[model samples]
Target: MQRVTKERCLEIISRFEPTKEGREKGHLGIDGFTAYLLSEECDIFDEEHKEVCQDMTQSFTHYFISTSHNTYLLEDQLKGPSSVDGYISALKKGCRCLELDCWDGPNDEPIIYHGHTLTSKISFQAVIEAINEHAFSKSEYVLYITNQNLIFLLLNIEE
Candidate 1:
């Protein structure tokens, strides 16, 4: 990590009038300002502020998450094609949660595609495999999969 010098820190604080005055008055410097920003009085994280400096032990609901819907559809919902590339794309762009709409295919295997429409289908296993390969490439958090499936046995799909 690059260290912020006092000059650089002062320059940054100067953009805001209140902080600039505090720095000019010599009441706030790099170390003091950094400590003040992290202090409980700042209320940066609210009730969960302690978790900011420590490993997170809070429930997942306590945090905001980036999510995407119909993550397999690359284009129009009704007429476009579905592909694992869409999932890979969303995951690469920092989507921590994805929605996969699964439907029964003509073959024994389950496929992913938007249902009740004319969308093209992609192999469900292919999407899962793509997700497995790319889920953690951009993020350290657990990827949440919201599987919406029709009431049918999803067969011949491997992990």
Candidate 2:
């Protein structure tokens, strides 16, 4: 059998990271390993991406990808990923796929809330700072992944 090398391992990881399942918490650590990749390149050791992906991956294993019916009720009403909760809930209830909208935030933080609600009280930097502090706690329910260009606007009304 061919021995797995770091480059070969990275090649394997690159394929998995794009899937919703690969991004899940339980699988994140174990799944990123390739047959012969170095510890540094493994997703388990990448501090920055791990920070953002850890929490969001919490329930990924149990949850199946699905769509929400309520989205049609608010299709024209809400904008961006803010509708994820409704869709996530619907996915839990049995929806198969979902559509999410996204918008840019100050400093490109990608606020996932709908519309311009965050524009008044906080800036993207402030939100990132706050998330840095609180995101890992049990009280919060967001997974913080960095996007190169597009910003996310999530709405966590439950909080």
Candidate 3:
């Protein structure tokens, strides 16, 4: 992202792109964009972007949350299955903002699922439990659980 040139773009895409097809086709996709954005070469002057930071005691607002839109979907929006795996993966990766699209489920329980046509459903309790297990495994930063179209579940944060 420093300089734009045919050679530089190709080198960046080829090395950072997630999929072989994208790397082969020489196009920058979302995953590749994220990789490049978080890569060291993205901001050579700023050492905070590196994997291991010298200081992590700064305020949450000072750093990017490393978040995503729909955290419970493993695949595309329409056909993906929602599960706690998504939450676990994000939490382990130090993602701070996680979204839970809760809806009234059978027997008075809340559930998380895609907002698309797919029927992927997982208990909201399961998602919360997973978060509790993994939220502090990576870092002690605050985690924001954004609930869409339903009651929110903000956990007890001790930091």
Candidate 4:
């Protein structure tokens, strides 16, 4: 792996700095940083379309990658039913990116569910299995699975 040095970091910051003084001083303003973050070099869609040959400079809409949120929910994210079939359905619908929420479950097994809601939990293993079976069914695009890791605190009070 290539290690990032201070000089390389400064170079990257300067590339995104809007003001000449900030660039010379290796300072990244909020505007410059936000622009850098929203740029194609750091965009997931651009990363997935690395093989495509086109004009490098374009708006975000130029990338037409489809994505899904709460992929395991059949209805509302707050109180919907979660199932492995959701993953299958989303993949079949040409969703190249799927979002999932994972939390600690019984017996140390991780499960997928919408926390603090009525959404039912589905086995993380089952979701993975479903994805493995249907990820490439609709398109040859690389599938990006984004999972939100949750941490909880249990409180005990004596009245």
Best model per TM-score: 3
RMSD to truth, every model: 10.9, 17.6, 7.3, 17.3
Predicted structure 1: lDDT: 0.73
Candidate 2 regions exceeding 4 Å error are 1-66, 69-84, 113-159
Tens digits of per-residue lDDT, candidate 2, 19-52, equal 5665443233444444224445443555664343
Instruction: Flag regions of model 1 displaced more than 4 Å.
Output: 1-55, 149-159
Best by lDDT: 3
Clash totals for all candidate models: 0, 17, 0, 0
Q: Model 4: which ten-residue window has the lowest total lDDT?
A: 149-158
For all candidates in order, the CA lDDT equals 0.73, 0.40, 0.79, 0.78
Model 3: ten consecutive residues of lowest lDDT: 149-158
In candidate 4 the C-alpha lDDT for residue 84 amounts to: 84
Give the poorly placed runs of model 4, Cα more than 4 Å off: 1-62, 149-159
What range of 10 consecutive residues in model 1 has the weakest lDDT sum?
149-158
Q: For candidate 1, lDDT tens digit of each residue in 75-134?
A: 898899878888899989778888878778876888888889999988989988998888
TM-score of each predicted structure versus truth: 0.58, 0.24, 0.59, 0.54
Clashing pairs in 1: none
Model 3: residue 152 alpha-carbon error in angstroms: 6.6
When sorted by TM-score, best at the front, the candidate numbers are: 3, 1, 4, 2
The positional error of residue 123 in candidate 3, measured at the CA in angstroms, is 0.6
Better of 1 and 3 by TM-score: 3
Q: Considering TM-score, which of the candidate structures 2 and 3 is the better prediction for this target? A: 3
